[model samples]
Target: MSGSLRKGLYVLSFGGIAALLVLVLWRRELYLPLSLLMIGLVMLPFFIRFERRRLRAEELLLVAMLGAIAAVSRVPFAALPSVQPVSFVVIMAALVFGAETGFLVGSIAAVASNLMLGQGPWTPWQMFSWGMIGFTAGLLRHTRFMASRWGRAAFGFGWGFLFGWIMNLWSLLGFYDRLSWPAFASVYAASFYFDLAHALSNVFFLTLFSGIWLNILGRVKQKYGLLENGRAG
Candidate 1:
């Protein structure tokens, strides 16, 4: 993506999110439409770039496979509330592929997994959260910081809490009228342990598996000449 276009997307996504929150708070009945709008704003740029890239059949299949793997990863840890390998998978995929691919993988995983886990208003929020995690990770993939294992682990750890916080926003919307600082604090406090588990799990996965996954994915990219343009195509 061009620098100008990326900047535009950043503005649109952040501005749209802020507007959506205000609109939702002002008129709760508009939640569904606003939620859809949120997804569109967050996803539009990447999909547009993806379309332009025109990935080959095999490459597309690879994306689908990674997404499916991420979706299924949630099943084994169904009993663990917030602890799951989904985020780790998404992050790893993003680190190997580019941002557009990462976003697609994350969003696909969210929708696909929720089908088995049960969907609700929370689904879109999850899609947004995970998608952003992948997007941001991919964006920072080349950074000196992310080039290190500790940096990758830290990235994963941060997203663990961030993912929970994003999900909590959906729950908060349930009683918008009763929202207060205390209520907000309590809601986050309630999720503290679950979020911590998620963060720690991310660190654990990244510490032990990032190198292996990166090497595997890097080899695939090399062997297939996939993403030769440095982005999915």
Candidate 2:
């Protein structure tokens, strides 16, 4: 296929996957497998492009290092279900790097760690949630919101809850096939305290350490001159 035609096919495939994801929002079982496939599909083009650039090898190295940090950070917090610094690390990675880097790091962190943690249907959702969080941070890095300390704290606070909420979907889907607001609310309520801990931990960490992390990452990026064209795309 011509390059343009090949690109069009990818676009169509992504769109189709997106539309199906929407359609299966209430169908728990179908949602898991489809969402899993969707993540893989999204990753396909990203790695394809990675092969095109020698520069990307350096970028990939940085992403791997950051991703390893994110994944390993989860180990220390095993005593607690929700409170972890992985989110903070991923967010800072995005803030310093860019969306693509954030996305890759977040996604890889999930998949790679799951290999050690033991993968299951929930793996994809974990990947998607963390990946999106990182992507959003990177996307907003230049905006005034990300530029302010208060804003970064707010972002951290929000993503902490956001992470838990997405994980709740796993319980909702895997446990209950027939969805209802009451059941959903029950699941959410059960997870509330854990989520709050995660959120507060994020707020505290961002309040105290975001500046330091950003400065360190900034030095790394500048020393390496990474992601020169904004995002990888």
Candidate 3:
């Protein structure tokens, strides 16, 4: 991505997120619309970038396959709270494919899995959170920091907490009228363990499986030249 465009996305994402939080705090009744707005603001750019490309069927198939695998990976772990391999899969995809593909895979995984798991107001939030996870991983894929397994593990661990915190905002909407510091603290406090499980799970998956996934996906990318020109940023 061009430096200017990347800067624009930074501003758009951060500014939009801040605006959404303020709006949600001001009027909880508009949560649905606000969420939709967020989804558009955060996702539209990447989708537009994708649409401009002349993609082949095989490239499209790879994307679908990755998304399907990500969504399906959540099923067996339904019994565990927030301890799924969805994030792991998304991260691996992003690392191999690039940012735009990563975002697509992440968003698709969320919506597809929710079809079986049940969708609610939280769906958009999951899409946004996971999408951003892939987006960030892809953006940093070339960096020396992310090239290391430990660094990637650290990234997953941080996102584990970050994803939980983002989801907590949706829960806080229910207590809008009674919103207070204590209430906020209580909600997060209650989620601490669950979030820790998520974070640790990311670390575990990244530590044990990242290298293998990277090698496998990397070979496929090289062999077929999928997403060659359009994946960066």
lDDT of each: 0.87, 0.80, 0.88
lDDT of 2: 0.80
Per-candidate TM-scores read 0.94, 0.85, 0.92
Task: Report the backbone clash tally of model 1.
Answer: 1
User: Candidate 3's residue-wise lDDT over 3-85, tens digit each?
Assistant: 58867876887689789878877788887888778767878777866776778899889999999999999999999999999
**Worst-scoring 10-residue span by lDDT in model 3:** 224-233
Q: Give lDDT tens digits, candidate 2, residues 1-233.
A: 34696588669768976786676674655876766777677666656654454565777788899999999988878788878887888889988878767887888888888877789988888888888888899889999999988898899888888888988876776678787999988999998898888888888888899999999989988888887653362
Of 1 and 2, the candidate ranking higher by TM-score: 1
Q: Which predicted model would earn the best lDDT?
A: 3
**Ranking of candidates on lDDT, top first:** 3, 1, 2
Candidate 1's C-alpha runs over 4 A off are 230-233
lDDT of 1 by residue, 93-176 (tens): 888887778888999999999999999777878888899899999889889989999999999999999999988887887656
Q: What lDDT score goes with residue 145 in model 1?
A: 89
**Model 2 alpha-carbon miss at residue 222, Å:** 1.1
Predicted structure 2, TM vs. truth: 0.85
The true-versus-predicted C-alpha distance at residue 84 of model 2, in Å, is 0.7
Q: Who wins the TM-score comparison?
A: 1
